[model samples]
Target: MEKQLSKKIKELVLGFQINELTEALVYERIATFVKDEKDKQTLLRIAADERCHAEVWKSYTKEAVKPKMGQVRKWTLLARIFGYTFALKKMENGEKGATKAYDEISKEIPEAKKISEDEDRHERELLQILDEERLKYVGSMVLGLSDALVEISGTLAGLTFALQNNKLIALSGLITGISATLSMGSSEYLSAKSDGEEKPFKSALYTGIAYVITVTLMILPYLLLPSSMFMVSLSIMLLTVVLIIAGFSYYVAVAKELSFKKRFIEMAGISLSVSAISFIIGILVKQFLGIDI
Candidate 1:
């Protein structure tokens, strides 16, 4: 005799049913566009598993339900832009929480035990095998980003007060940033070559690209704005620093399953701290030397 499901358990089952079906469709759609044979097959396998899970939930609900179209489209588009690894990991993260929900429902229904296990464990292991180039070179990104934040932020802060002219500051910062980017890239290439990194050239490229992008973003305010409005430009530059730190930290957290709050605060704090110290130094330098730009 089948045990009767309570109202709460029934609702949970129905919701899971809808989500599973939606995700299955999302995976299938992404698989069609993927060029790699291994990747396509993996996506298809996951889609099949999702469909199986949906059927499991349907048995409890005893009702046919449509997938949530909005959710399906969102994941599909995200995968298309961000690549399958990020999108798949992001979707898997959602399933992590869903496993806990499934665990609770499993108390009333034994069949849900397998569903919870698959969601919590097996899916994660499967996703670990997916090759993601961006994640592989994340260390290079960190190196480039950290150096830019510390060096550029400090340079801008000190110059903002010392030069007191946006054009002068922008020119100086751009020159310094460009030189540093080249130097950093060259050093990274030589170091990686010596260390026997599989692709030294590629690593160096990532470092240079990251550094150049950061420099451009940091210098944009000074280029676009008037030289007289130094304070406003300075504030905007500072805000850009914070936003860059926050944004990169978030991307890393999602892709690598790291602590977002800890990473964000640490990077922001270090960058801002250096800027503050340099700002004071600039004021002292200007007053003591009596040099004005």
Candidate 2:
């Protein structure tokens, strides 16, 4: 006869059961749209592992449990938006604590140890074959974003004090930003070509897109606000810069398994420092030149 689980152990086992089933559903759903055969196969295999885990837990719980459809939908939507690699990494990171739980539960149920080992294997497999396209051009994206943040943030800061007119600042920023985007794209293209990169044009396109998007976000406040609200617009623009840095940093951190805090602080610090210096220069220039526009 099988050993009966205690009430507390049974409840914990059932929770893991639900989690495993939900993840299985999520993986199966993601596999449908995945184009690569290898990647699709990996996802399906992991989904099978998840199902097996749920079954193992079910034997102990002595009852059936439903998959968390909400969690399934959430992961599915995240994968749609952010790509499967990020969503998978984020999901895996969320489940790290479960391994410890399984370890503790193994004393009551020997099968828990096997389930834990399977979980570790799932991670190894996913990490090995997760080849999302967007991740390939992260360097280009970072180049464009970092350059835009540093250059445009400083330009906007200087113009906000020097011009003192939101409309004028917006126009100036748009012209400068668009010109810089083209130049950066062309430069990246040439650089990639010289470096013998396989897809130079695509690299340049990614760089240009990242640059233009960052420029639009950074200059949006000035365009939307009144001339008298230059200070407010500048403040909002600066905050937007921080937010962009934070968001990009988070995305890269999750997708690449890097340090979020370190990247955020470094990028934010450089962009704000340049902006501060330019702001001071703007004040001094305005005072000396006596040009009030």
Q: Best lDDT goes to which candidate?
A: 2
State the C-alpha lDDT per candidate. Answer: 0.87, 0.91
Candidate no. 2 TM-score: 0.95
The window of 10 residues in a row where model 2 has the poorest summed lDDT is 121-130
Candidate 1 structure quality by residue, lDDT tens digits, 209-256: 989899889888888999998878889989999999998898888888
Candidate 2 Cα lDDT to native: 0.91
What's each prediction's TM-score? 0.89, 0.95
Model 2 CA deviation exceeding 4 Å by range: none
Q: In model 1, which runs have C-alpha deviations exceeding 4 angstroms? A: 1-8, 33-37, 95-104
Candidate 2: tens digits of C-alpha lDDT, residues 145-247: 9999999999999999999999999999999999999999999999999999999999999999999999999999999988989999999999999999999
The superposed Cα distance between candidate 1 and the true structure at residue 145, in angstroms, equals 1.1
